[model samples]
Target chain A: MIRLVPRSDTPALLQVATPVMAVLATMIAGGILFAIMGYDPVAAIKTIFWDPLFGLAASYSRPQLLVKAAPLILIASGLAVGFRAGIWNIGAEGQYIIGAITGAAVALAAYPAPEMWIFPAMVIAGAAGGWAWGMIPALLRNWFGASEILVSLMLVYVAQRIAAWMAFGPMRNPEGFGMPGSRNLQQYPAASNPELIAGTGAHWGVVAAAAAVLATWFLMSRHIRGFHIRAAGTAPRAARFAGVRPETLVAFCLGLSGALAGMAGLFEVAGPAGQITDKVGVGYGFTAIIVAFLGRLHPVGILLAGLLLALTYIGGELAQLTMNLPAATVQVFQGMLLFFLLGFDLLTRYRIARRVTA
Target chain B: MIDPIALFLLLLSASTPILFAALGELVVERAGVLNLGVEGMMIMGALSGFATAHYSGNAFLGFAAAALAGALVALPFAILTQFLMSNQVASGLALTLFGLGLAALFGKPVEGVKAPTMAAGPLGLNWIVWLGLAMVPAIWWFLNRSRAGLILRGVGENHDAAHALGYDVRQVRLAAIAFGGAMAGVGGAFISIATVLQWTEGMTAGAGWIALAIVVFSNWTAPGVLAGAWLFGGVTVLQLRLQAAGVRVPVQLLSMAPYLATIIVLVAISARQKFSRRAGGAAPGSLGQDFHALR
Candidate 1:
């Protein structure tokens, strides 16, 4: 029998190699899954992993990579901050919805206006909306000792309902013959989150995603608060003894993550998604959780992980269009990636040893 | 006017899935493991059950398939967390993500397919509903009276002490997690085969999370889970009634009932747990911590 011997320190080489190993394992596993579904496994794997970036449709799909990656990177970066402090804000989806609603509300209320301040003001509203939504769990945990995980998750359903209400009722486009969506923000230039350089998918959201990656990297590595956050997650009692207030940490982590997720929503609404529809949330928030883990909860790692996941999204779409694969295959593939990552992560903290038979 | 009996029946049906899932979670928690992938497992069950029922023309077989699927999905989680000593919370989340994805993938072929009709067992309720009701006392006995149950609880209360006492802590928790997965799967299958009578992506729709909250609301007791499930079911039934009655409130707001009710219930139960510290049964001592059997 083999026994796992706990390592005194996490192996640095394994720390880096595990994510890479997880991806390779997922590829092999995912390939087998495709083969079981009767598709040519190699072609399907190539379609999902290669075609999006370098296939015949690379020109079209490459740009979408950034568009898809933006929300993921933004949300994962925010979530990573909280994850570092052992604060789980799983309701970024809710925050994303509320942020889109609030931000779009600003644009709709100031419709067809040529004001410069409208977009910036909408951004603030979006962030604030998300921040407030995140506070529900934080405050509940702080005041009543509720589990943030359940509270935040429960809030996602409520946010979805609220988003539906907004689209079906209050934000319904009047000029579109009773359609259940807001006016396309893309048409509204002052509020649009358009690509700075056409065909590159380099919109304000992408820029913000980059900014988030940098800022989080700086925060985690260089700041005292970052030190506190890391300390709290690793050693809660010690953190408390060192004067790190648990409530404040929870509130801050949740709030920051909420704000980032909300901004991602706002950007998507104004850019690629182009409207506040009932279906505006398409699981970016949940996917971001996978991105955070895939990246090993590191900011730079998250950037690469987000891009990798985005490749799967673009490739998944291509696979659906070309091979008649179901759209859900992408979601399944991502789920496998996270599962493999967690499984492989075991190697970092422990070594398998052969038990000596007496 | 809506008949009270119809409303009660609807409440029972609506609550059945959550009740089943929560009961399973109650056992898992009682054995000191917190599995958050109830939603994922439930969805896997929903998909597999529907697909099986559609192909075999047998609902019972579908449910059995679902239970097996759920347990199979959860096996990875048990292996990763219990044996490999991975983070329980992260592993559980991965299980959920994987389950949802795998379910959707499996459910693709069954989309738009109609489920076989299920006959009522007693009191105009389905057999699963009755099973859910029966599970309360059955589980209560298993946890409170049975010797194996005591060993499970001992493992949960303190693994180190349990280890000293010669109990297989990893094996006990693995059994509990697998049972939880099977229960969650059955609860999920209940949604597809009975309640919705159709296969749809994400049909479980946060029922798993609500069940998680219910487990906590029950303070990890079988009876508490039943009451919590009923309360949620009542809210779900009332919300649908309000929609049918065309009350002035928006349908979206009405749809928020169960989720809002969950939060409220969580807060209330947490406060109660805080106030009555000596009452015990708050949470398992090692609920989310990964256990490693060191030599």
Candidate 2:
């Protein structure tokens, strides 16, 4: 019988190695899945993992990696903080939507204004909108014994509905013939989140994502509040005794994550998405949760994980075009990667033994 | 105007999916495991049941397949949390993503195909609906009066003590997870087979989540779950009725009622627990805590 013994100490290197192993395992398992689906597994795998960067369409896909990774990394950076503090805010998708709406409201209201301050103002509104939405769960949890996980998750549906309402009722483009979407921000130069350089796909959101990683790294590893968060997660009672306020930590974590997610949403609407629609959320908020976990909840790790996941998005699209694979194949691949990563995390916590021995 | 009895039957049909799911989740939570993959399992069940029923032209067989698929899909979560000691929350979320993606992938071929009509049971209600109603009393009886149920409760309440008393915590939790998955699956199948009558991507929507909220609202009781399901079902039915009547109320806002209601209920119950003396009264002792028998 197989038995597991708890390790006295988990090696840092082993933790890093585990994700790589999980990736390899997912490739093998995903290949099997593809084979069963009657596709050339090797070609499918190559298309997904290698083709985005090396395939014939690499030129277009390379820039897209940044465009996709930006939101995921930005959102995950904030989520990692909350996760570290034992707070769960699973409604980033909702926050992102609300943020986009609020951020775009500023631009839409200032229709013909060529003022340089409009975009900055929109950014503020976006962050504020996200903060307000995130604060709902934080306040409820602080006031009551409510589960933030359920509360936050419920809000996602609520947010989706709100996005739908806005798209159909208020934000419907007047110029378009009864289309259920906002005015295209892409066409509005002042409002648009344009690329900073020629073809690199580097927008303000991408820059902000890189900044979030650095800020989070410093906060978690340097700041005393970060120490409090770590302490609260590991030993709640001890952290309380040491004067760390649970409510404050809860608010800080939720608000920070919410704000970051909102910014991500704002950038998306102004850049790649270009308009608010019923389908605005697009699962980026949900996928970022996987990114956080995949990154081992570390800032640097999250950067790499974001890029890897972005690769899947681009590669999944490429696969759809080149190999005629179902779009869900990428989703399945993402899900499988997370499953394997979580399963293999067992190795870091315990040692497997063939026969029992003290 | 909608007839009173007709409205009641509509409510019953509407509530059945969530009822099945909430009841299954109740058993799981009572057994001290929090499996958040109800949404995933239900979607899997929906797809599998719809596909099976579509192919075989037998709706009954579709429900059966859903139950089986749900159980099979839940095994990996059980192993990860029960044996591997992974975080239950993360694993459960991953399970949902996996199920949704897999279902969407496989559901492509079955999309737009209408389900064969299932033979109606007594009183013109679907058999699955009646079965869902019957499960209420049955689960209450099992949880309150049965010997195996009591042992399962003990394992959930105190795994270490239960292990000392020679009970297997892992086995009990595993069984509970599978049952939960199966129930959720059937509930999901009800949507595709009986209600929607066709397969659609992400059609289960947030029914699984609403089910989770109901488990909390039920205080982990079967009859309580029934009441919560009816309340949600009633809201949904009324909302649909209002829509049909061509009221000026925005459909999107109307549809958001159930989710907002869930949030309100969760907040109210949690506040009561926080302010009342009976803190941690209804929740199982070992809920969300992984159990490992030390050597």
Candidate 3:
């Protein structure tokens, strides 16, 4: 018989080591999966993990890393705050879509105009749009006692449909022979989010992501609200007694995450994606969930985790081109990482012992 | 000029997947576990079932394979939540991602392949649809009248008390989760084998998520799931009819109706529970909490 006994204190070493262990385990499992699928497992692994950094195309791919990681880091930073407070806003994807649409709506309405204020104004509108969409579930949870998890997720589908409608209906580009997407925002100098430096791939969104990490770190470690969030997560009754209202926290977390996710969407629409289309949401919001967990719900950890996940994305694309690896392989790697992390988390909380039969 | 009987039959076929998936989830939730991986399981079932039917040329056997695949896939979640004492919500999400990715990886082989059709049953309905229709009463009777179900409900309501009473909470929950997986698998197979008759990547789409919403709208009852499924089915059939008849409504907007309806129904039910003094329609007490039997 096996017995699991609870540990009184978790060692800090184990906390750091477990995520590392999970990553290593996923590599081994992913390699085995590749082998089973008749691919050259070692070469596939190298193509995915090593080639993106040190391969012949490293210089070009290295800069692209920041472009990919920017949205993920930005979104995960916000999600970590809510997750720490035991509030789940899993519908960041929906908020992202709405944010992009609203943000782009500003530009589309002011099309062919060279206004200096369009970009910043679009940012605020985008945030408000996401905040409003997020408030639906938050308010529902606060007043009606609905599960925010389900509500938030259901809204994702709704948001996707809305995006499709916009692409084909109101937002469709007029001049380009009836293509089902808004005008490319990149061509609009006043509204476009351009790269700050020449070859570094650093856009305004990257700067925002850096700011979010620092801000989140400050909020979590140095603020009373951070203390309240941790308290609420660990012990709800005690936090309530200490005068932290659950409703207010719910609204704050959901609204804050929604706004951040919305900003990420705006930045993407104005920069990399360049237009609001039916396929604007390419699973960044969902991927950020894994990023948040893999980062241990911490800011600095999230920064690093976002970069690592970004590496996987770029490398996965490289592998697909060179080694003919399936696109789904990267997704499987991410899922396995989370699973292994969750499974190994048990080691931090409990001691496994074998029972001696009498 | 539309035939009501044909529409009704379309509704029956359209709703079978959600019915099976929701009914399965109802049982799992009743036993105090929330496996949020229904979407993953369903997609897995759709792929594996379609692939098997394509290769083996036996649609019934494909369903068996799907049921097995679903239960097997669910085992990881069971281990994570039940044995490892992991957080159920996070674990369930992980299961969903993992299942979807794995299915997509394997599903590449069977893409665009046609699924073999099974023999039709009475009224030109598929046997699986009939089986799903029959499950409502069987599950209702099982939950309300059977001794085993009483024990299962006992475990869900209060695991510690049930444990004290010497009922193995872990065993009961494990069984419930496996049964839920099997049902979801069959539901997914019904989509690929009977309805679409073709394999496509991510073909189940959000049917599994819809099933999850339906379970909530059902108030955790078997018969309620049937009604919820029919509501969704009716909306789907009506939208297709409208689209076919060249109605000017945007197809995307039309597709949004069922999800919007689900949200409204969820909010309404939740409001009722919150405002009412009795609070009679409560979820299973330990629904999302993990159980660790430490003696």
| C-alpha lDDT of residue A85 in model 1 | 90
- Which candidate number would show the highest lDDT if scored against the true structure? 2
What's the lDDT for all of these models?
0.91, 0.93, 0.90
Model 3, span B121-158: residue lDDT tens: 99999999999999999999999899999999989888
| lDDT, candidate 2, A1-358, per-residue tens | 8888889888988999999999999999999999999999999999998998998988988999999999999999999999998899989999999999999999988987888998898888899988899999999999987899899999999999999999999988888799899999988888889999978999999999999999999999999999999999989999999999999999999999999999999999999999999998999999999999899999999999999999999989998998899999988998888899999999998988786555
Residue A258 alpha-carbon offset, candidate 1, angstroms: 0.3
TM-score of each: 0.98, 0.99, 0.98
What candidate 3 gets wrong by more than 4 Å, as runs, is A354-358
Could you tell which candidate, 1 or 2, scores higher by DockQ?
2
Ranking by DockQ: 2, 1, 3
Q: Which parts of model 1 have CA positions greater than 4 angstroms off? A: B279-281
TM-score of 3: 0.98
DockQ of each: 0.85, 0.85, 0.78
TM-score of chain A of each: 0.99, 0.98, 0.97
Worst 10 residues of 3 chain B by lDDT: B273-282
- Predicted model 1 interface RMSD: 0.8
